[model samples]
Target chain A: SAVISQKPSRDICQRGTSLTIQCQVDSQVTMMFWYRQQPGQSLTLIATANQGSEATYESGFVIDKFPISRPNLTFSTLTVSNMSPEDSSIYLCSVGVGLNTEAFFGQGTRLTVV
Target chain B: GIQVEQSPPDLILQEGANSTLRCNFSDSVNNLQWFHQNPWGQLINLFYIPSGTKQNGRLSATTVATERYSLLYISSSQTTDSGVYFCAVGGNGNQFYFGTGTSLTVIP
Candidate 1:
């Protein structure tokens, strides 16, 4: 089992500002994923961060808007840039031990744009 | 991309009542899980039944991969069980697609 710890449980940010959320895992992992859950919506995958390579983003999401960094196997960061009111949502990070394994999630960072 | 649809978008149950949640997937999946998101927005993993049945305490889940659906059963509900339940499925890729969650409100 993997234990993920995400920082900044909740943050209220001004528009046009950027916030970087960090995720740390208890153990080393090969792949870490970033997700966004808009108000009253289900979670949507933002990107997959693999150490030593560029994060692969999902459609409708781009690298410039949500840049990701994976400095090592146990840590990753996601930055929401040029934020807008529409960007107000809960961002979460996840990690799975391996194939066919149950995935674990962080407590999630709630961002409110004002 | 796979489509995951969950039934009973919202539910209100009395304490000690029992309820069942359903999750339907559009394609075959390699992983399926049930999670409960508390009011604080913390997602707690409940089950990881990809192709079989798993029970933990008052909560149980069954996944029929061939039928392309899964079910989560909560027996003897309590006020603490009031939260949003989500079902997530993963296909061949590493990404997991989440279903439209079922918001459950349990009252005493």
Candidate 2:
């Protein structure tokens, strides 16, 4: 299991402002993913951040709204651009070491847009 | 795209009591995991059981891949166990589909 550290545990941002959440893992991981959990809702996958390329976002999610960057194997960042009140959610970063291993998640960044 | 559904969306149990949570998937999967998100919103990995059964302390999980369902058994529940339990399923890809989750409230 990898230890994932996420910054900005909680933040209150004004609408239309952008916030970049950082995720750093202690050990190098092959797969890093970003997820969003709306208030009282299940988590939804935002994108899969590749080590050196653009992220592959899931359906209903696009790069313009949630741009991602994975500069290395152990670090990644997800920026919520042009945010809105509907964008307020708990964003989480997860690291999966292998196909059969458990994916570890960061503490999650709680964002509230006002 | 796989669909994961969890049963008993809301549960209230007494401390020291036992409870069972079920996760059902719509398609075959290569990976399945159980996670507990505490009230503080920290996601804790409880079990990574893709198949068969695995136990840790009072928590046990069994996954029947062919049946397309999994069961998580919590014995002697604690007040600290009050939270949401989520089950995620994935195929050969890195993306996972998460269930709606079971909200458990263990009253002390």
**Candidate 2 residue-wise lDDT, A1-114, digit = tens:** 788899999999999999999999999889999999999999999999998788999999999999999999999999999999999999999989886577789999999999
Deviation from native of the Cα of residue B88 in model 2, angstroms: 0.7
Error of 1 at A90 (Å): 0.6
Alpha-carbon local distance difference test for all models = 0.94, 0.94
Off by over 4 Å in 2: none
- TM-score of every candidate relative to the true structure: 0.98, 0.98
Q: Categorize the docking of model 1.
A: medium
Write model 2 residue lDDT over B1-108, tens digit each, in one string.
Answer: 899999989999999999999999999998999999999999999999989999999999999999999999999999999999999999885577899999999999
lDDT of 1: 0.94
Badly placed stretches (over 4 Å) of model 1 are none
What lDDT does model 2 reach? 0.94
**How high is the TM-score of chain A in model 1?**
0.98
Clashes of each: 0, 0
**Candidate 1, residues A1-114: lDDT per residue as tens digits?**
888999888999999999999999999987799999999999999999989999999999999999999999999999999999999999999997787678899999999999
